[model samples]
Target chain A: MSGCRDWLAHLVLGLGAALFLLPIWLAFCAATLDPAAIDRGELSLVPRLDHLGVFLEVLRHGGPGVGPVWRMLAVSAAMALAIALGKIAISILSAYAVVFFRFPFRRTAFWIIFVTLMLPVEVRIIPTYAVMADLHFIDTFQGLTVPLIASATATLLFRQTFVAIPDELLEAARMDGAGPLRFLWDVVLPVSAANLAALFVILFVYGWNQYLWPLLAATSPRLDTVVIGIVKMIGIDTSTEWNKVMATAVLALVPPVLVVVGLQRWFVKGLTEGEK
Target chain B: MERRTIFPGWRLPLLLVAPQLLLTLVFFYWPAAEGLWQSLTRTDAFGIHTRFVGLANFAALFADPRYRSSVAITLVFCAAVTALSLGSGLVLALAADRELRGRDLYRVLLIWPYAVAPAIAAVLWLLLLNPQIGTIGRWLVALGVHWDYALNGTQALLLVIVASAWKQVSYNFLFVLAGLQSIPRAVIEAARMDGAKGFHRFRTIQLPLLAPTLFFLVIVDLVYAAFDTFGVIQAMTQGGPGRATETLVFKVYQDGVVNLDLGSSAAQSVVLMGGVILLTALQFRFLGRRVAS
Candidate 1:
């Protein structure tokens, strides 16, 4: 009976994992199929190579007012960079100061930053949009990038990383006539490279995958990220072209999927190994 | 090296924190405060005209049947997704905990969905479940169970819940697997020696040890359901045939963005934020204690 139960559990787990990954695999398969074939409701497990032309069409055919894939890629890369860089710079500096210094409101500042975790961007979407409009930043890259620049989670993660650094390292740098700025640049950053890499993957993936904010902020097609673009490709009309949508979906997923697969080791370490 | 603090002690920390603080103050705190203020007032299109109506917006939202339905839907969605993800995640973690072949392959395949954006997930599922040509829909029809998310509200809700749950199961599995791996083999062996096996051993020994990880996952899952799934809903059903899947966050987006009812939208946001804050605090207060113990 015990052996039977164990086998059942294993079977169930394998089935569950297959089901969980089905949609992703199916979407990719559908993306590679010809629109005519898809429209005919032909369900083929293996996507035919002849249907690969849809990718080229999706890239070349600027549907309606939609920009080219290269333009969309540029905008997404630029906006993602701005947000990631701004967030990392601020988080690193703030974490450095908080970990090293003993200043007034030190504890209070830390608490405030931590509390922001509870106050997610979704909660403040309405007001944040209004603020963007007020600042005349609506539909601009700055609007998309600025509101997300200060991530409480990143700050907390960086602070945890900084706190794990040995105190003796900083002290030794101090004794060797290294100033705070020099010490941070020379000693601290080197030791924290792994942590920073981990955080970089987390932040980069996050900024890349961000959707609602860009959706709300970027009203025009000009500023749409790959996410919003793929969503828009879902089509408001009932006769929505499933093949085109799937093709666009495949394109949108490629960058972040590649990033995750490439930096997966650091990503896993950042999430799991950090707490210890 | 000398104890000569560079340029007054407060200057450095302040400067260090300046960028983040400024960004947060401008983007987060200011908007949060403005949202509170807007919830109590009336605002016009183009956001130029405004009037202080004071609690009328809140009163209207509370009195509306749609708001009430949204509250119920949001609760059901959050609860269902949380239970489904956590239960499946725990089972998968437990199964994967054994020295099984192809373990790494299973792990990678299981987490593959986590890499897909929620918008894409919704889109993919909608295609697979479409009434006419959907692969699953065709299969269901073949099995004699007529399943059409477009026509059936319960089916639509269940589909959304499943989609969201599937997207997150990987994350939960990752955490739970970590937690399970951390448990010493001696404990399980000791339990087995005491005649604890199968469900008995799992329930008493493994579950107790897994509580901390489970607690963390619950909080994280709640937040994701509430805040993160908005895009999914937007892409999947657009709140559906008759407001069936109109979650609070989706409602807020519809009101603020689509409908242009900024005042009511702000009111909804405030209420949503209040509920989230309450839920988070309750989780920390209750499960946090258990974990600590």
Candidate 2:
């Protein structure tokens, strides 16, 4: 009976996994087929391994209203890295100050940042664009990244992590004549490495997956993130190269999916715990 | 929650927090305040003249049939996406938690979709569901189902919901799986000894215990379907088939960015901000037990 139940479990889980993997597999196969065949609604389930160079071909060119796939990927990578690292750095500093120091209006500062949780870019679309315009951040890389770096979630998580540190540890660091910065470097960072890793993966994916903000902020095709670029590629569907679009979709999926899967343990920890 | 042993000076800590504070002030607070201010005022088409018209934009919005329809569409979209995603996630999480062989492998396969952007998810689904060139869509056509999301409003809305929910399932799966794993085995064994088994055991014990996680996921998923699926709508339908799939967020974008209707758009934005604040407050009020710990 137990053995029979286990098979049922396997069947259920396998099907669940297929719900995700099948679409991508079909996409990969479609990417390998001829574009005309795909446009003719003849998508195949099996990939043509011989024609796998289409992924390379896609990287070299752009569709109508789309820039080079490689450039978009590079833009996405830069934005993701800047947002992830910038958010982590500043969040760590702010969380450290909030947790470790006695300061005036510390609570006020924390609450101000916390209120941002209520104001995602979705809610403040036009006015935020206006602000970006005012600062001359429109169409610039800073416009794409800096405005997104201040994170309430990362700060809250880091503060939670930092608050759990033993007072004795800080006393010991101080006894070693370590100043605040030194203590933060030598003790705080290393102690919170796992949380940092978790936050990195979460924030990296967050940064990579941003679509609306990028669309609003960067009008120049030069600054198009892969997510934005793919949407543009699909916009002109009549003139769209189907196989190239599929291949571009495949390429776009690789980086963030790799990060999430590679750091699966930490990513799960960060997501399931931090978000709640 | 402050540490007992603290850093001595106010200066260093203040300096440390300055960057985030500044960014928050400029990007978050300033924009939000501008949105509130814009909500109360009107601007002409050429951006030349501006006048204060307190709550008139909001009044106009409520009176507009399109705005009312968008609200109805949003509520339905949120409910459908949340229910579908959470339901599938619970089922998969339950099956995956059964101590089966290769469960770890199954997990990695399921969890990676969380990384796929909402826009990319739309493209993937479009490849499968596009009646002209999509694999499954053409299959549906061959079956004589008259399936074209482009021309049919209801079909377009359904497609958008499916795509949005598909990307979100992995997130809910991760959380639900964690919640399931954290349930005490001893308690399960105790229930087993009491003759509770399988579906009965799950419904009676595991499900109730999982409420906190479920509640948390509901709020998150609703917020996601409300705000984050803008990309899915943009990429898939552009809220098309004659304003069928246009949720509030999409309409905000449409009115504000595309139509350049500053007053109405800002009013809509203010309303959304209020919705978010209300939702967040509700979560904190009810889920304070879990979040506080």
Backbone clash count, each prediction separately: 0, 0
Give one digit per residue, the lDDT tens place, for model 1 in A144-223: 88888877777877776777677667667767888778878997788777777767766676677788899888888888
Evaluated against the true structure, the overall lDDT of model 1 is 0.78
lDDT string for model 1 (B157-269, tens) is 88888778878887788788888888899998898889997788888998998887787788889888988898788787778868889899999988987898989999998
Worst ten in a row by lDDT for model 1 chain B: B1-10
TM-score, chain A, per candidate? 0.88, 0.97
Docking class of 1: medium
Clashing pairs in 1: none
DockQ of each: 0.51, 0.85
Segments in model 2 whose C-alpha atoms lie over 4 Å from true places = B291-293
lDDT of 2 by residue, B1-293 (tens): 55679879999999999999999999888998999999999988799999999999999999999999999999999999999999999999998887677877999999999899999999999989999988789889999999998899999999999999999999899999999999999999999999999999999999999998899899999999999999999999998989999999999999998999999999999999999999988787766667576
Local distance difference test, per candidate?
0.78, 0.90
What i-RMS does every model get? 4.0, 1.0
* Candidate 2 lDDT score relative to the true structure: 0.90
